[model samples]
Target chain A: MLVGYLGPLGTYSHAAALQQYPEEELKPYGTLEAVVEGVKNSEVELAVLPVENSTNGEVRAALDALIAEIGECPEIKAVGEVRVRIAHQLFSRSSNVSQVERIYSHPQVWGQASHWLSSTLPGAKCIDCDSTSQAIERAWEDKNGAAIAGSAAGSVYGIKPLIANVSDRDENTTRFLVLAKQPAPENKQHTMVTFCAAQQDLCKTLEALVSSGVQVTFLTSRPLGTHWTYRYIVEFAGALASEQVREALAKLNQVTPVTVIGAY
Target chain B: MLVGYLGPLGTYSHAAALQQYPEEELKPYGTLEAVVEGVKNSEVELAVLPVENSTNGEVRAALDALIAEIGECPEIKAVGEVRVRIAHQLFSRSSNVSQVERIYSHPQVWGQASHWLSSTLPGAKCIDCDSTSQAIERAWEDKNGAAIAGSAAGSVYGIKPLIANVSDRDENTTRFLVLAKQPAPENKQHTMVTFCAAQQDLCKTLEALVSSGVQVTFLTSRPLGTHWTYRYIVEFAGALASEQVREALAKLNQVTPVTVIGAY
Candidate 1:
């Protein structure tokens, strides 16, 4: 099976893809939208995309792509999830960290490793790249450059790791979702839904779920292309096949149209 | 009054500060944390910091700083809010847009103007800076460089706006909070609260608020330094002094200790 992931390779999404489909053929896509598109077009059998980070909250780009694409292509659904423990390392062409004047990485990586960067390389200029692998490639070519990435990216670019686990949080992890043309076999572990409702109806909508006795595991709100109006993405612990989930979703749909993204 | 903001005089925070205190002495700080520190230390009478953007959702760094600082310094509170309409422009040293080889801006600015950048200057390499004003400074020095910033930044850096309103969304706005040593005089407009609760109690906690008849205006959840545990920040259309708000908060505190960030 061909699996697509957002990458030039060595992204956290790539890591998650590898973990979930160890022996599958992996293809690199430039953006989350493209990865979803690959699955939508059947160019790839499956695709992996990062959804949330332990410290960064929701990955907005991924959520945005999923919300937009799933609305149009109802067949495409999130079928599985993989959690990748993030471990950032400072890689350099030279072993001397003091001489490094420029550091490069994805913007998110820079934020995760900011505490280490400030304490160790306070004077270095931080540059942003599209991916951690791209950062390593750039560092490999620059004389006074360093990059923060995972061990996989460091090995890929033949860069030596000068320091390991530089992120501020030791247990930082990212959650990745596997998207396919059909939903996963019902497991009763979790169900994800997205909907938009007026402020007055939000409580009513949420109450529908709570009164059904399903625990909401995750909830986030994003602006719906307007100033203060918002749409909510919610995850609850239940299967669509269950009576409680079916009843809850029915009531939720009555309050506001609910799109069931997936049940896994 | 002396006001502090994250700035080099051209950032959006600077614009918000100026709008709120046109005649006050404005000082620039390097980060949102520093802006909060300015108020905590009484170095500035008040400070302005961006809290949420319509396009980008919550400003994580700002929220983190506010959460961390408020825990220790309860005297500091958000007293007022200013919503600044975000209008991004492509500013360049040269008039020829085709000649621009690099684009510089804060990471958030890059994301906001990504659509325009991809369509207009598809080949330009984007470099991240600490602030849009810093991006303007970098662009000013590079002959083949352009930056995405507001008109205020363009004027400050003596760069010309090659294109106007490059953001994908026209009604994009950022909500900034005014931080001071004391809460604003009582107003029944809005109140903000934050707290951490287990997954099982989240519905019950929210129900407490809804039962008291306060309309929840905004709600967002961030991981509480753990894998799945989360803390929520919520905004409601009520005042702290209002009977409904006080009753709601008291009920909410029963489920989870609630921190009233401010009422404005």
Candidate 2:
């Protein structure tokens, strides 16, 4: 089977993909849209994308990709999820931290390491790259540059960490979801749905789900893109096949557009 | 009065600050954390920061800044809000679009203009800069580069728009909140609150607010940073001084840790 993920290589998404399909040929896509497109175009059997992080909020690019692809590929659904502990390490070609004049990493990585960066290398310039591994690649090529990436990136790029476990928070983690063209099994444990409810009707919609005893595992709002209001993505504990979930979704549909992204 | 906002002028935050406090001397800070620090240190009486966008969801940097400042400045509260329409223009030192070989922009601006960029400048390299105005400054100094920024930046940086309204969406808007040491006036119309609730307790918390007829106006979640769960920020339609809102919050506090960011 072919599995797709966002990468240069050695990204957290790559790690998650490996955990999900250890033996499969993993293909790296430059962007989330490209990964979704891969599944939509039958270029890959499954795609894994980061949904949220313990230290960062929802991954907007992945969520936005789903919002944009809703009409184009109605069959896409989340099949399963994997949680990975995130540990950012400072990798460098130079053995000494003082020799590093610039640091390269994804912008989000900069946030996770900002506290350490200011105290350790206050004068260093931070250059944002497309991905952590890409940052590692650039830093590897530069004489006076270092990068913040996972140990996997360090190993893949032939760079060594000057310091390890540099992330500010100890409990940092990322939740990734697997997407495919098939619906989840009927016996799945969780269901994820994306819906468009107007700002005025938000409370009523929440009431519908809560009143049904549908344990809302996660709830987040994204911009509707065409207006100033928001569209919500909710993950609930029961499958769509459950009677309670069906009734709740039916009531929610009375107020706004609803789509079952998948059950897992 | 002095107002602090994200700097090097001509940014949407600058526009929002100008619209809200036209008479105040606008102090430009290099980062959102710096702006918040200015307010905490009384270097500025009020600080304006972007919270969310109609096209993008929440501004993570602003949210993270608030999270970091929560313990240090418990007195900080949101005083008011300002909405600014974001119209990204392709500004260039060159006379034609074809002459532009590279594009410079803040990462968020790249999202708003990605569709246009892929079609118009398929071969151009996108370089992320610190801010939109900073991107314009760099582009202005480069012979074959263009930047994506507002008209204010174009005017301020002595560059002209090669094409206007280059944003992919028509109704791109950003919502910004004003922060200050003083609490919002008791008569303010809306109240905002941030709370920490375990993922399992989310439904119960929402049910409590809904059952109380609290009319949740807005809701967004952020990572708790220290744990694998989330901290949610909710904006509702009633002031904290109102008996109904007070009772509702009291009930919510029974389930989770809650803080009233402010009423405005």
Candidate 3:
């Protein structure tokens, strides 16, 4: 099977794809939308896209792609999920961290390692790159520059880790969703649902789900392309194949338009 | 009165501050945290901070600052809000848009104007700067570069707008909150609350709010600096002075530990 991921090629997404499908053929796409499109166009059997990070909250681009695809293309669905531990390392050609004048990284990396960077490199100027790999490349070319990326990416670029695990929080993990043309087999452990409803109706819908004894694990609301209107993406601890989940979803459908993204 | 905002003089936050308090003396801070700190430290009578953008959803850094301040400092509160219409213009020192080989912007602007950039300047490389004003300065220095910023920013830098209103959505407006040491007058129209609760209790709390006929306007969940646990930030359309809102909040307090961020 061919799996697509956002990469070039040392992103946490690349790490996730490798962790989820060690033996499978993996292809790197330039953008999250492209990775999702690969699965939608059937160019790849599966695609790994990061949905949320423990430190950074939701991965907006990835979540937006998932919401757009699942909402517009009925066949495209999230089939599974993989959680990857993210350990960002400072890579530089120079041996001394004190000599680094500037650091390059993806914007997300800057947010996660902000505290560490502020304390350690108070004078270093931070620059944003399109990807961590691109940052590493920039760092390699600049004598006084460093980049934040995974250890895997540093090895790929022949750069040494000046500092390891620079994230503000120790347990920084990212959750990536596997997307496919069809939903996963019904034997999975969790079900993810997306729905749109008015504010009052949304409250009632949650009440109905809770009353039915559904354990909702994660929930987030995104604007539904208009001011003040929102659509919610929810993940719960039960498979769609289970009767309790089905009944809960049925109740939710009655109150609001609900889309079961997948069970996994 | 004095106001603080995130700026190097010409950011959307500056526009928001001007829109909200044209008569006040406005001071610019380097980051969102600094703007919030100005209010907490009584350095500024009020601080205008962007909370959410219609096109880009919530401003994460601003939201994070609000969450941290309101959670830690009881005196810090969001007192009022101002909505500013955002119109992103491609400003360049050169007269021709096609000659622009690179585009500079804050990371959020890239997300907001992505579609316009990809279609209009397909060949241009995007470079992220700390702020839109910084992007404008970079564009002024780079012979073949353009920056996405408000037309006001363009005027300040003496750069002309090569193309105007590049945001993906036509109704691109950002909601800015006025943060102060004390809550707004209770006669205002809305109340905002933040609370951390277990997943099940969260649903119950929402149900409780709904039962009292409170209208929820905005709701978002952020990770509580941990793996799976989350804290919810909610805005409702009733002032704390109103009987219905007070009753609803009383019930909410019974269910979870609720912090009334403020009323406005």
Q: Against the true structure, whose TM-score is highest?
A: 2
Q: Write the per-residue lDDT of candidate 3 for residues A145-224, one digit (tens) a residue.
A: 99999876876677678887788888988888889999555778899888886665666676667667777788888876
> Candidate 3's error at B14, in angstroms?
2.3
Q: Which 10 residues in a row give candidate 3 chain B its minimum summed lDDT?
A: B199-208
Chain A only: TM-score per candidate: 0.96, 0.95, 0.96
**1 against 2, candidate with superior lDDT:** 1
Best by DockQ: 2
lDDT of model 2, residue A215: 84
lDDT of 3 at A64: 83
Q: What digit string (tens of lDDT, one per residue) describes model 3 on residues B145-220?
A: 9899997687777767888779888888889888889855688898988888776566677666767877777788
DockQ of each: 0.61, 0.74, 0.52
Which numbered prediction scores highest in lDDT against the true structure?
1
Considering summed lDDT, which 10 consecutive residues are worst modelled in model 2 chain A?
A183-192
TM-score of each: 0.93, 0.94, 0.92
Q: Taking the tens digit of each residue's C-alpha lDDT, what string does model 2 give over A193-257?
A: 88877678888898888888888878888877766578888888887788878888888888777
